[model samples]
Target chain A: EHPLWEQIGRSFVHHYYQQFDLDRNQLGTLYSDTSCLTWEGQPFQGKAAIMEKIASLPFQKIQHSITAEDHQPAPDTCVLSMVVGQLKVDDDPVMGFHQLFLLKNDNDKWICTNDMFRLALHNFC
Target chain B: EHPLWEQIGRSFVHHYYQQFDLDRNQLGTLYSDTSCLTWEGQPFQGKAAIMEKIASLPFQKIQHSITAEDHQPAPDTCVLSMVVGQLKVDDDPVMGFHQLFLLKNDNDKWICTNDMFRLALHNFC
Candidate 1:
């Protein structure tokens, strides 16, 4: 497997760990120090800030399964798409999500520059 | 090149032709017969409806440059990201756009199921 593929796989595992146990340390390394994580225009910047925000989430447990994965690569950058099935709060299936990850290669390591996801939960409203 | 790669390249060329001359026909085939194209919350469904919407765009001439491309593939689907530089309307350099394409392969051909793009134009406003 290409190094980029390994990085992406690692990122997903890290996400699973964080989601299952609310492990802040596992989640922190996935993002850059200056990275920004936004949901519905609310931005959380930096590792500490992002961890704090995630730790504050009311969900007790999360189980995410990647139903599909796709990648498009240009030179050193790649975009990853995952159709995610997530179990959140009360262990109920909240919604399906489509996530887009924009990654760049920095010093032979892949780092996610932008991550955007949409939930089917909105359709229920 | 894999068949999937060819399909992706063809899609980009099709996009350029549509953009350059306001060609409605070229634009219509890029999407599925039951596809949905949405910006903000406005959704355009089906081919004829989407073409009508594009034909209404006031841009006279458009030039688009793809600064980057990336792909991720799983089974039969792939996601593409294009950092597009566009010259639109009145020959002004309006802004850059990041376009995300979610594609599915049906019977050996690829069709875009969803397309999302963000314009730097919004940042200026």
Candidate 2:
């Protein structure tokens, strides 16, 4: 709710997606040992496990176009962010996706502590 | 990450949707003055304002069918839950939706501290 939350949240989201699209391997800088990620209902914990799953994402080329996003400050100096966006993989058609991230400041740098991601499909896949 | 988070998250989601579908007015019991909600990019703070928005939702009858959900324990004993689901409003076609809630215990009762909601449409609306 504070103005600082908006600044922090926007900056974090920008850095996250930019790094994700450019080089997902660099995303490890945004997580730590206690980080947890739920990608399409599959849960992965810790930086190593999460990075392994991210690196094996099945696609070589991808781009994300964000449609809308909301950010709020949560308890304990954490920022909660939700994103609705479209992603293009290889030659595949653009697919809608929704993601949420809970970020906390560690050593003055924002690190993702929790993440949830899914393709916005009508039926569960 | 913790088993208790799953239990608490599942229970909270069940009660939340049931109350939402049955009587949205009763949904206020899950919020407080410090709560915040971002409903489709529109931000509302506190119980009174949030309830006003909920009460004015354009549809009289609605039914939600959850497709998938994920829950994890966050900092400071908070539970973060994300839900992917479909909802039918009145006689309209079913629409996909994604929502996230940050739940924390206050006086032994779980209260929603932050909520984000959006309908899964390809284009931002």
Error of 1 at A17 (Å): 16
Each model's fnat? Answer: 0.00, 0.40
lDDT tens digits by residue: candidate 2, A1-125? 55898788888888888889999998998999999999998999999999999999999988988888899989998999998898888998888888889999999899999999988765432
Model number with the top TM-score: 2
The digit string of per-residue lDDT tens for model 1 on B1-125 reads 64565457556645644554564447666677765454432456666776677677776666555544444332223444333334345567555544566566667666666554444332211
Candidate 1: clashing pairs of residues: A70-B72, A70-B73, A71-B71, A71-B72, A71-B73, A72-B70, A72-B71, A72-B72, A73-B70, A73-B71
Which stretch of 10 consecutive residues in model 2 chain B shows the poorest summed lDDT?
Answer: B116-125
TM-score of each: 0.46, 0.95
**Which digits, one per residue and each the tens of the lDDT, describe model 2 over residues B55-115?**
9999999998788989998989999999989898999988888889999999999999999
Counted clashes in each candidate structure? 10, 0
Residue-level lDDT of model 1, residues A14-63, one tens digit each, is 56445546554466666676554554334566667766776787766665
lDDT score, candidate 2, position A30: 90
**lDDT of each candidate versus the true structure:** 0.51, 0.90
